[model samples]
Target: MNRSSFIRRLSLVAAAGFASLFATSAALAQAAPPAAMRETMAIGDEPGRVSTEEVIIREGAFARQLVFFRSTEPVGTLVIHTSERFLYLVLGNNRALRYGIGVGREGFTWSGLVRVSRKAEWPDWTPPPEMIERQPYLPRFMAGGPGNPMGSRALYLGSTIYRIHGTNQPETIGHAVSSGCFRLANGDVIDLYSRVQTGTKVVIRHAATL
Candidate 1:
C-alpha cells in the first residue's frame, strides 16, 4: 500500500479499538449497583468517596482514645452533648473517644442527669408510645437480633427511655434523626457497653455547649 493509504487504515483500526473499549466500560458500569444503593452510606465533602478502611480497635472498640475535638474540658468523664453530635469519654491525659452520634430531633430532644443503669447485649427494643404513634408503620416491638435498630449492645441511661444504643442504621451514625436517643454504630456501642458498668454516670449536657 502507499504510505498515506497505510496511515489512514491504521487510524481507522485505532478508532474502532477505542470504541470497543469504551463500550465494554459502559456495560460494566451499568451492571454494577444502582445509584441509590451506592448512596446508602454517607459521603462527606465528595459524593462518591467512602472510607471502607477498617478502623483497628487496639484493645477493644470501646477502649477509649486520647484526643478531644472540643478544646476546653478536663479529660476523665463521659460527656454526651447531642446537639453538638459528640460523645466524649475522657481518658484523663487530655483526650476522649469522640464518636459521632445522631441526636434526637426537634421536640424529641431532651436533657437530664442519668446513669448507665443497665447494659445488654443485643437488647430487645420496644418503641415507646410516642415513637409508635409517630411512626405507626414500625412494629410495636422488635426482637433483639442482628437486624434490630438497637444493634449489638445497649447502655440504658438511668430509668428513662433514653439509651446509648447500637443502631442497625449505621449510616445514620452522625446526624440528628432520633427520638431523644443517643445512637452509635453497632461496633462502637458494643465496645462502650463492655467497658462501662451499671451506675456509670451519664450526664447529658446541653447539646449546644458540649
Candidate 2:
C-alpha cells in the first residue's frame, strides 16, 4: 500500500484497539460490585461505625443499595415510601441510598414531612404510654444496649414519637411490623447515622395510589 494508505490503515487499527480496550473496561466496571458491596459491614470499637454499610439480609430488590434516583428533593433529604417498604436517602446526581425498612402496621401507618430533630448512639428505649397500652408486656424504660429495640442509633423525627432507628432484629427490615417508623439493622443504622444530620428533611408517603 502507498505510504498515506498504510498510515490510514494503521490509524484504523489503533482506533479499533482503543475502542476494544474501552469496551472491556466498561464491561468490567459494570460487572463488579461497589466497594462496600464487596464486603459485609463497617464496624468500630463502639457503635456509629459508618454511613454506608451493605448488609444483604435477603435476595430481592428491597436489599439496600445506592442507585440512580431522580427527584426534586435536594440531596441529603430523606424520602420514605411505606407501601413499598423502602426509605431513600437522596444523594444527588439522580441517585439515592435505598434501605429496606420495617414500616408501621396498617392502622399505625402515617405520612408527612418531618425533620431529623435529634440523633443518638446506642440510644435508650422508653416505650411510650400508648405503646405500652398496646403491648403491656413491654418495659416502660430500657437503657441503651444490645437488648434495646432502638438498636445502635436513633434519628428522632420531628416532635413525633416515631424514630428512624436501628433494630436488633435485622429480619424485620422489610416488613410492616413497627408501630410507625423506620428501622434498619444495627450496622446499617450506624452507617445511616454517620450520613444524616439534625434538621435533615424527611418526607413520608403514606400510600402510592389515588
Best by lDDT: 2
lDDT values, one for every candidate: 0.55, 0.65
> Each model's number of backbone clashes?
1, 3
Which regions in candidate 1 have their CA more than 4 angstroms from the true location? Answer: 1-65, 69-76, 106-108, 134-137, 178-180, 208-210
RMSD of each: 16.4, 19.1
Tens digits of lDDT, candidate 1, 78-178: 68865556678766555566666655442124576677888998888786665555456767777787766666778887777778876654445445542
Span of 10 residues, lowest total lDDT, candidate 1: 41-50
User: Which has the greatest TM-score?
Assistant: 2
Per-residue lDDT value at 182 in model 2: 79
- What are the per-residue Cα lDDT tens digits for candidate 2 across 50-88? 222333343456567988889899999999876677889
Clashing pairs in 2: 50-191, 51-191, 69-94
TM-score of 2: 0.67
